[model samples]
Target: MTSRAIADIRGAENLDDLYRVFNENHLTAGWHKKRSSLWPEPRTSFQPLNWRYAEAAEAMDRAGAWMSTEDAERRNLLMFNPVDDNDYDTVRTLVCAYQMIKPGEYARTHRHTANAMRLILDAEDGVFTVVNGIKLPMRAGDVLLTPNWHWHSHYNEGAANAYWIDVLDVPLVHRLEPMFCENLPGGHQEVTSVPDPEACPFVFGLERMRAELEQAPARADGTRRHRLDIDAHIPTVAVTYIDMPAGGRMAEPRTTASRILAVLSGAGAAQVGERRFEWTRGDVFCVPSWHAFEVQSASPALLLEVSDEPTLSKLGFFIRDPAQPK
Candidate 1:
């Protein structure tokens, strides 16, 4: 530990001497000396995303008008958060995109390892997603889950284009190095008996869910909350519906889970740190991990919140510090 020893360690000329110095200094081989050169804290390059519904819908329409399902595959415009030009991620572990299917068009059958969900931005009859032979109608303000490795495809029988926000844990799955996807043999998956979209328990009906929660006991926190229990099907991601009454304010909450909130109805403002972001119906925004955030509703507001809570909880890293000071 003397200055002379430290100088000798730094001046080592041979591998054996270096190894001896490393051992004496309580260091191991490989990258230990390089660790200090990296960033001192975790840096998430992703930024908050807010794409207006009209803009998104128009872009999707243009794409749908020119591109066929066979040519464009999914007809999706992937959302890129502000970050390094080389990085294409909506968030650290998530990817969000706007997808559309035109009238009489279909998104071909395919499945992947990453868990996916869709929040209907504009709903219409005849626009349904077939997952593993089950047809679930996509309705406005409703959330549909296409769990990991499930064969799914979308079809638009309605006269208009179906628009939705598609979210997946792509970054997480890709980083884990087990990403796999396969396309079905035909343009779409085989359809079983046409089932009622309302009957599917996996679809979270926004108004219905809100009404049910209204009848239930209110939370001590003053927010009516209802979470879709799809852990048995989609284990990585979870979606919840939160309703805040007019003039209501939710105290800032901190959690380890990263959340994306879509305003289904009414208007509200979200405060993160010292910045406040106002949101109205059809707007989407993100809340990064461990950032204290509070929601204030100008009127009765409903939000569809998507997060990787189940994944973090399963990995033993999920923490909810509601008492944390902002």
Candidate 2:
């Protein structure tokens, strides 16, 4: 690991002598390594996993019985990967959480270096998220952005509890060692303006997305996809909305991009590598990088997919099966 150690290890004469020198100098020889540094394909440490919405919702209900905004920052269940070392990440580069807010509760105001977004799973009319003083509505099937360092908080004024799927590039930030966070002086931020949901750049309403997907032609695999055009500023993540009709199936080509997908409507099943998952509305699942996947709609379904594709493409590390969609 050190230049001096490398220098000392190179002065040995024979194989045993070289290994002894390596041990003495605390060095490892590339030629004698037990494992190669490069591989023919990605071997991700994380595995494909799913977090059912029903289980999370039930947990949230139980938490709501005692936990409040005063007790925890967010009443949520983290979709942690079921890996030996991973405790917080849903995939290698992202962390997904199922968050719930009860009526008349606040999630407090804070911001971090991690870019984040939430897919509204079961929100009512009075649920809203305030980002940098702009209030945006949180309705079912809507996607709202809270980019890095933009102070944001959630509040529910509706009579019912609000639930949403939160996806963030926190694990990526944590790995990069540039993570930073801060809280507002007051727990809740003052809403300086309330923009029209139609014109607000931070809000992608369900109606508009559905309209666009309806007008788009289906792919050869019978799935219509719209690359949500809201990533002009957020560089780490790309969002896509896929619409599949009943019996429609998409055999996704293996790609070097890990993704977290949430079912926004109807029911579906997904095959990630050798694992299969049957999902309904609000269920979230992950597909690790380089895993072959297939999605089938038992009923007309809509999915919200979030991936690190933009980051990989920008870094020139992106690769996919030749059959991948354009």
Candidate 3:
């Protein structure tokens, strides 16, 4: 056996010596493929960031390996819900999206700040978002908010890999220089909400929302969400859209943060404070910080909204005196 092994080892420098052949004589003299280089070589080109889905999928494969790791097995913080902890200073405010994947199931822990929210570009029946004492069901076109400094998390209780776009104020706060963070020292924060869809004041089913749209004339006039202030809307806070009928006017809301209105499937006018906007489907408009505006749906129209909800509660910032028109 020894003689045979010696015969096989003839002219062989051990494994390391053989390995050095590939290491030292790599494709250095060959064509330099800048495209595959870890660091940019002589030739580099720029591509739109949105055009990286394939590369992202490959990265996700490696990340999945880490997620299925033993470390993840013991600790369940991997899937930090977007509303519960999506804020990380550099993201969110720039209006970016991210993912939180976990191997096991269920991420149930909550603290204030680093909150999470989701826009369901795609959703699964088993994927549900539990936020601030309420479990709001998920669906496409649903604009959800995981309020600031609030406890929240998500669960993919379905068979397939559920996913959604996480939305938060991380970018805004990161720019502001205050990146607050904390963990539930004992455990998750108290479950202020249950998984009841009705628990949430505003319910948006495309058909239902369509039916509920109040008709305002189509002359030079307009329409709005409601004449009522948020406080008056109460526990059943209805986040609504306003349409401009005949004239150019709006019934504004009681608000503190600049409203973000994304026009969905319509052509219209949106005026905040004093500025007016000509908008269309896929167009985005904003109300300046702490100002109220009226919207005139140029034609028939629709929109999406996010607001200072529970965040206003902790700070005691949102309210209106019913005695006065807010």
lDDT digits (tens) for residues 6-63 of candidate 3: 4544645776444444344442322433355453212112111121223333454456
lDDT-better candidate, 2 vs 3: 2
Residue pairs of candidate 1 with colliding backbone atoms: none
Instruction: Please give, for residues 83-192, the per-residue lDDT of candidate 2 as tens digits.
Output: 88778999999999999999999899999999999999898889999999999999888999999999999999999999999999999999999999999997889999
Q: Give me the runs in candidate 2 sitting further than 4 Å from their true place.
A: 1-26, 322-326
Give the higher-TM-score candidate: 2 or 3.
2
Which residue pairs show collisions in model 2? none
Which portions of model 1 show Cα errors greater than 4 Å? 1-32, 36-43, 321-326
TM-scores, all models, native as reference? 0.84, 0.93, 0.43
What does candidate 2 score on TM?
A: 0.93
Rank the candidate models, highest lDDT first.
2, 1, 3
At residue 207, give the lDDT of candidate 1. 71
The per-model lDDT (C-alpha) reads 0.80, 0.90, 0.46
Per-residue C-alpha lDDT of model 1 across residues 1-326, encoded as one tens digit per residue: 77977898789898889788778877778754645656533334455556566677888787766788879788887766776773456766788888888888888899999989998988688899999888888888888888899899999999888889988999888889899999988667787856665677568777778777787677666788888888887788878888888988877566777777778888978886555788888777777776667888999988878888888999997877746653
Cα RMSDs of all predictions? Answer: 5.3, 2.5, 18.0
